[model samples]
Target: MNAEGKAGGFAPGVAKAEGALRALFPETPLQENDYLSKKTGARVFLKREDLTPVRSYKLRGAFNFFRKAIAGGATDGTFVCASAGNHAQGFAYVCRHFGRRGIVFMPVTTPQQKIDKTRIFGGDFVEIRLVGDFFDDCYRAAHVFAAESGGMMVPPFDHPDIIEGQATVALEIARQMHGESDARIGDSLVILPVGGGGLASGVTCYLRESGEPTEFAFAEPAGAASLQQALVEDRPVRLAQVDNFVDGAAVAEIGAEPFSHLQDFDARAVHLVPENRLCATMIEMLNIEGVVLEPAGALAIDALKNYAPETLRGRTVVAVVSGGNFDFERLPDVKERALRFEGLKKYFIFRFPQRPGALRDFLDLLGPEDDITRFEYLKKSARNFGSVLIGIETRNRANFDVLTQRFDKAGWAYQDITENDTIAGFII
Candidate 1:
């Protein structure tokens, strides 16, 4: 039970865990974000976990896991773990920190940026093995490696030591918030992003234990609402499909160990953020505040949109900006998702009449502010009617409604394939 942590409040030895973390790095900042504060009419502070050594709070867990295992007489000094990007980098960082030999398993399809960062952090202390094409595959491979090699497997989020280590973020937040504000901790609200439930569980447990009566909100990826689903089913259930756009926070199944600390919460407290909407948040933060956040990092900020301005007015709220390992190469995709989510961009399939002036007639239906971004003939050889894929960008979402009406009036045979995943995947 000690390994899984106590059932109530702070996990056993979490205080010690926090103390151990101080040697690793200084506390990450809790800076007030004027942009978000004004937008929601709430005092918004961002816990800049994105500013950590590995650009994430993951190092805390990985370091503590290795420290505990080594201190507890599990010699041989070999450690292993599986991760997508952030966790691998964190584990590698911590391995180099302690000068310990480590093995990291990551997906073969993991971005080059992440792979290079992990290598940079580990230096000579860690070996990275690219296994399968997904996290699950790499995870299984890590387990098999540990089993055969008798190496200690450092779980990304499921172990008690990891949970305790993650709790250090809450400890820092408590101290930092109290120092920065004259108001009681109870007056403040804490919003956390949930992936495998490690960060949320640890922070919640620590807050409760430290006698903070603060309000709490959990932000989850809409495509992978593992924590929300677990609360409903009263147990962890594997998701049928998981969108990995917010790769850091996308987990098919919530961790069993972390779930123990979070299972009793009200489902309403968990907000599911759409992938596209999260991209909008990322873009907003980057363009406005000059903060380049990964999709998972933006989840907590995006969840603030779930609350009305009136409800949040005058409230002091904190959001954990979970990570900033975003690859700039994906900027175009992020922009596209953001545009689509805002309704400023759309894709449509039109069955144009086989006439010489058909395109001219169709172009005339577009509003003044509308611009055609893509127009490709799906069947150029057709005689009677040809199918064409068209992508339109507009100044306003309302313009689309007006354009749809015009299309109907013109008797154009078209399908709004913007939201059609199947057609968009193949055609767009």
Candidate 2:
């Protein structure tokens, strides 16, 4: 079916899909958030898809895909998927729920926390295979294996059924908004995070088909803005490089099926969030709301920063909190990124004279509020000079400016390497 024809039937189809999903778990909450509302000057609500059994909305799509496949009496009853994150857990959960054997192919670089969770969800019903280092490698391997084994493949996104399944989120949003006294979805703006575009595309298509005058915005990781690139180029294009920090949404390319539904959106409507800046949002939610959000999960909420408070004033806005499968082990990295993004932390490489009190002299240049977080002697670069790596944290960003002026006056040969991606990647 054509995209338009498929979209025409989405309202009823999504309603049915959402009804069937209740057998597995109740609908996720759509709660009003005062913290966000006050920050943006908008009446903000959060569609909490993070509360699902697999801690992601991926479960809805996986369940619907399996449910339809079983009903159609197709093949030998085994299903397969390739995912390094949320989709794998969702697929595994559905596999066990349906009592069907399944195979999950994940990149070998996937964190053990995610791998262990997928296994626990699927239990004995699913077998996991660690494939290559990247998702594309595992994806190709899964397809070849499915072809040879005659097993059906359940895609992470891209398939029509998966899109329809994800549309249920919007279906519930519309109903829930109506129940909240005089709140109409038609007058609201919905913000969704874009990865391969399943959730965003599905939600937008369903809401559009419902004949609501709803506005929409999209969020994508700045490091992997595939949907924004597709909107600009008028076709889905593979990104040359992707930062996997936001692993759940760092798709190299937007899925063709999802792009078809999303292509008409203006590139301006899509906000590209920096990976470092996203960490600040995650920490904000964690500390203030006691809400844990994975990097990709925080995309929608972080995009709110792109809007001026006056622009969103008095408007009803909904931001989808997509997932919360955070591994606590990454907290230090997250905190480091957040501090850097906030400009309160920096790193520098200094050429220090191999003489007495050189370290004391450098320390004397620092502001009262500046604290040395890291200091290491890399090597003796010359007979009289050694290379020292120094990290500093301060109460204010302006302190760095004063410190840099002191470095120049004191005749210190130094390179600010905080923003140097290559150097920071290697040494930080």
Candidate 3:
């Protein structure tokens, strides 16, 4: 594949960026995984961006932004960015690498582990500031601080420098494929996980420039499908609400610059990965392959399920594992989500008779495989009945169908609140 014609369209810039990246760390590995290959009936390669210096590809973009700012005569010696997780860590790592002062404003609600990781990465080169409870609040504070202190503000995405830096990942892929003896680089499928679209945009541009006849697919969290929305509207639109479960990739709005590069792709090429289903993918990787992945990191891998085995049979596919900064504290929640998505767990609101024997009667309906995970009584609605919240976990999903039938036959009143977001939000 020829990469000589293009100068600015991710070809020249990304090549230079790739050379510069060697100063910080070697290229992340692109290893073929037998597990995914067997599942899809395709040769699957994982671009393990999770193994990056900051445990994400975010370092590539942040480093490039700082490098250009310093080299292009930016007078400000301090850099500032607002992030709750991966971006903060990346920016801090780059600050330390370049011996520059950095101020990272993060939400007060950010986990201690993430905050500590950012501090460890930046060491003496960066200052951590806890601002507001939400990302928007801290983002506003970061802008104000940057303006007041005359510090250069680095955006998590939305900048050309950041995009170019991220394009280096694609450049590495092209180079690595070229070196592989059995790899068919030209006919491969490249699956990218879309956050703000920086990584996807950059990689697509570079791969096109490299003249690789590769097919591209994008995966976005269903609750935060900013990229898909942008493509649909032919312009970027801010979502009223975005689920932050896939924190690394949950963007309410796609970046303008990235959208410009990515808008050409067809809407059908993007897959919306459900947050709950993503938990299953994350657990599968962890339990089977010993790979720990954050929600967004599992996006591309989960997307492989979108295609049938026949469609991908004998094909070479690459899934970008975006990051691995998963907090073990959230493991229980991850497992719960996975079970719920798999239909092995459910929540119910039951009207129990206000009698001593009523509780025992309800418990008697349970099968041998059924277990009560949570049971709480709400306020009594009447003198004879009380509202009870019950969470059930079963070995088989079929048990729920039988249990519901038994409840109906016994004239027991119950409401399945497992998928009622509003009710679950308040009490669960």
Candidate 4:
């Protein structure tokens, strides 16, 4: 397809996206982040899509697709979309703006906050359908609904229109750099977080076409490295098992349309951010910079650790902060995971003597910095020995090393299962 045919607009997809998006809101900011720069020894810029009204870049594509669908005479039927988060919100907002009806299908497990927000946006113009327990199930239900109702289904990031629309982010990035572009963008390294590969493909293709000579790094959750898996096999491949911790960017497979533009990118360019480390980023950004990032939004920020200090020093770089749809209820879990990842916390099944002063003796070994977070007796083995679950937190990570050393010297029998997910998940 020609450029216009592929992107569904005359002025190029990015340009068309820019023109079409003005009706909704101004472009997201491209601001230099001082805190990251200080820590990385590089000039750090943030593509602040997280500050959007819908708190995501998903709105850009949703708006563009809605405009084109209407222009292409798709107004006769209600627009349908399958999404639980930002995409659903964007679609609902666009549907209302155009005075068109929309049908949104979400996983039944979707948080109430998202469902409430989507409903609020669509108002009388939309209908919410809780379909399946997973995304694929909801997607299938959405397609079925569209076919049965003669409505068009608006994809989250797989469609050409969506890619072209999402490419507008790069256009805004270019403008924000005062036209000098990213000579200082840290050797043209733009770290992007990938979900269905929409933003990465769109931005990379635009920058390359503009002859920006930039380098692209893609970060996906370790649980869902769709782009990496796709590049490894030379095609999009579905993952049998996925960890959905990074809910914003966890996809079983990269979208075929988005992957086409990204096919040439090396698989090595993709970085998988650990789910626990991502939790650390979320907590750090919130506490240090007042930036609230969801797991997917923290991807690019977490990738900063992958580069050497010399590689990024004095060079300007950009990390796309994707979304901020974080629920407050998850804060404790986030903190727990972050502490565990940072080695400030540990869990073990310690063998304890049921003799008198046994607990007192163990407490005497603990340093002033050591605090017991959890203590439980699992089984009554005998009068001499009993199984106990113990969690210890310390002010310094090294303190745990000292504490454990003392335990070994004293002939303490304990099994550290802190890093064992199977054991931790079941008990903790």
User: What are the lDDT scores of the predictions, listed in order?
Assistant: 0.89, 0.93, 0.92, 0.88
Best first by lDDT, ranked: 2, 3, 1, 4
For model 1, how does the per-residue alpha-carbon lDDT over 281-308 read when each residue is reduced to its tens digit? 9999999999989899999999999998
Evaluated at residue 244, the lDDT of candidate 1 is 84
The candidate maximizing lDDT is 2
Residue pairs in clash, model 3: none
- Model 2: residue 43 alpha-carbon error in angstroms: 0.9
TM-score of each: 0.95, 0.97, 0.96, 0.96
In angstroms, how far off is 158's CA in candidate 1?
0.4
Whichever of 2 and 4 has more lDDT, that candidate is 2
Cα error, candidate 2, residue 202 (Å): 0.6
- Select the stronger candidate by lDDT from 1 and 2: 2
**Candidate 2 per-residue C-alpha lDDT over 118-231 given as tens digits, one digit per residue, 9 for 90 to 100:** 999999999999999988899999999999989999999999889888999999999899998968999998999999999999999999988999999999999999999999
Question: In model 3, what is the error at residue 52, expressed in angstroms?
Answer: 1.1
Q: Which portions of model 4 miss their true places by more than 4 Å?
A: 1-11, 179-187
Alpha-carbon lDDT of model 1 = 0.89
